[model samples]
Target: MKQGAQGSAATGAGDVPGSAVRVPPQSRGAADADVDVDVEVGRERYDAPGGVRGEHTHSETPLPRPRPAVQRASVRGQIVDALRTALVAGELRPGEVYSAPALGDRFGVSATPVREAMQQLALEGAVEVVPNRGFRVVERGRRELAELAEVRSLIEIPVMLRLARTVPAERWAELRPLVEASVRAAASGCRATYAEADRAFHRAVLALSGNEQLVQVAEDLHRRAQWPLVGGPGLRGRAELVADAAEHTALLDALVARDLDVVRALVGEHFRGAR
Candidate 1:
């Protein structure tokens, strides 16, 4: 994987590159090294409030490497991404009490890393951390989700339309695989993988829009609003997945033709479908 302006390329045999805010590779603690490892486990699980599972596999092999000393940013990144995913997926319901220690246990790490992660999440509006008490997942009402989707439409759709025009042809070559791969993953019922790939595709489009700040804001908003729709338990059924795949293809065709009106309408319809 090639590194992009916003994040590093995924390195290592089993490692997958993740967004700066939402990615963490699976690895075990130093003490559990000798066990018979069938499932390659992520160091943390971002379970939604009702136990919504994200991208994972049973037969995947663990990466063979020594655990590096924990870094604060990395731990915080994992926590933020996990909690954000949970919030979007409606797993960690609003007002739910969460213990830093329990989170630490769940991720197969120590309390310090979990605490660090929670603090970052609180700053992002995904959770609230009291000084003496632990953290709580912030509840977003359905109305809030609707309003958020509206706001995202206002911001993202035009940019996506503009990107189809302004971005150089060479960059389109770079982006094609991201969209096609996402469609393939979604078609195959790997929702988690599809979600990840879809995010990369959109982010790649945002990158082409030539506005870094807008891209950042869009990502923050997306983490809270859009992710849950696909990441949540409600995501299933081959028909729905096929529809999503078709949407991606339609968007691609519009981009290729530089049909701003068509792509804009497609973007609007795509998000409205989520509602």
Candidate 2:
């Protein structure tokens, strides 16, 4: 009914009551006729008494708008995220050199943002800076990845086992959503999303140990293990990702059940397969 009332009220001068009627554009004096009147549907503006515009009341808080610099920073962040994804997917080959301008062209962005993004990757050890050129994807040997996986297992397996024994089933059940998120990401076959979700799930589990330092070290190792390997198996297939994701669900189930034997076996197998 309110919609109908508003629609009829916004029709035109013919619908207005009494002296508040709007004069026809051509019949008004030259000064009045020269004024532009824009009436947008769904954004109707009502004229108050004496030809004044009524003020609209807002019940919601105004959202903050990002400024130009913030927008530029956001663009750079997006490029960094994309580059990391590419690195994980093996789209950026190890030992290969990539110029910011070339990558900028590929991403349809300016070279400045790409350069900034590459600088961030450099910090992350994913790429290294090349003077007078661009960045090169750091070549990671199979040994290096294997070693990282071993280190992660050394740190995480014990903590996970400890948590499985100590933490209540309800706490473990709270992590089901995170495990499901990893499964969804893996199913989509986006290595970047899956990598992040995977890390988040592990980090949540380790956080239950109440040891910030251990969690930080374990997370760093986990991330390094996911980097593209030199001369190793290429980008992992969807089936592989799905299998990896299923292990996450299985591990959570074991943890919730407080099954130490199953948790230990799954954790060991998961890290070994990660290499």
Candidate 3:
């Protein structure tokens, strides 16, 4: 699962071609005349006037500050994220073989990170590795999608119902932001964004159950359901996503009200519609 400037200029009296030499304090007024004074030189270089040319006096410009380095882990994670988005958007068609080097060129990254990201996807069951070739996007159909949704419903609906009875209304209300995020993402018509927000909302709700194992299992199932189908419309249209998101809001309200019947109904309908 995708788990988603300054410039400065300075001139001194030393600018004067014939100004008094700025000697070190130790050289002029310090009690310890024999003591060495270490002067830390900056990157900036100064050139002496032509008449006073010295060995150290040559034209030089300060090197530009190094840009922040992109870590290898970060690159791999980004590739994973991008691949997930592509999967949801149907841009990465199911059953299509994609080589790491080819996808690396598409993402403008090195093939190593792409390969690492593909390996992670393979673990998630989003793709399968093909020896001497590349990874192939797993082909999922409506039947599989429905099965995943049913499994999720079997796991999540009971937990949510139990939580509704035990967990406080305020606890459920805290998930409003996640539900609203789903709504906004759905309205934006970005399947990838909506997919993530959808999972996040459900995950947050399940997390209230205080069962990490349940949450993990439910989240994995939820992610699998969101993957594109092999045939037919793999991704829902904006209207469908919006309607689905609205059910989340309604479900949240029912949970907050501790209406077990309403929560159960909403959850059942939501999962059915997921098919």
What C-alpha lDDT do the candidate models reach, one value each? Answer: 0.64, 0.77, 0.77
* TM per candidate: 0.64, 0.69, 0.72
User: RMSD in angstroms, all models?
Assistant: 18.8, 12.4, 12.2
Over 4 Å off in model 1, which ranges?
1-70, 85-91, 130-133, 168-170, 188-191, 227-232, 235-241
- Per-residue lDDT tens digits for candidate 1, residues 114-168, read 8887778777777788666788777565677777778889999878877787776
Task: Measure candidate 3: CA RMSD.
Answer: 12.2
Residue-by-residue lDDT tens digits, candidate 2, 165-217: 89999999999999999999989987777889989999999999999999898
**Local accuracy of candidate 3 as per-residue lDDT tens digits, 1-275:** 00001111323223333322222221223343322211123322333332222222134233343333457888999999999889888898999999999999999998999999999999999999999999999998788877887888789888988999999888877899999999999999888899899989888988887899998998888878888887734447999999999999999999888999999899988987762
The prediction achieving the highest lDDT against the true structure is 2
Give the distance in Å from residue 272's predicted Cα in candidate 3 to where it truly belongs: 2.0
TM-score of 2: 0.69
Of 1 and 3, the candidate ahead on lDDT is 3
The weakest ten consecutive residues by lDDT in model 1 span: 32-41
Candidate 2 or 1, higher TM-score? 2
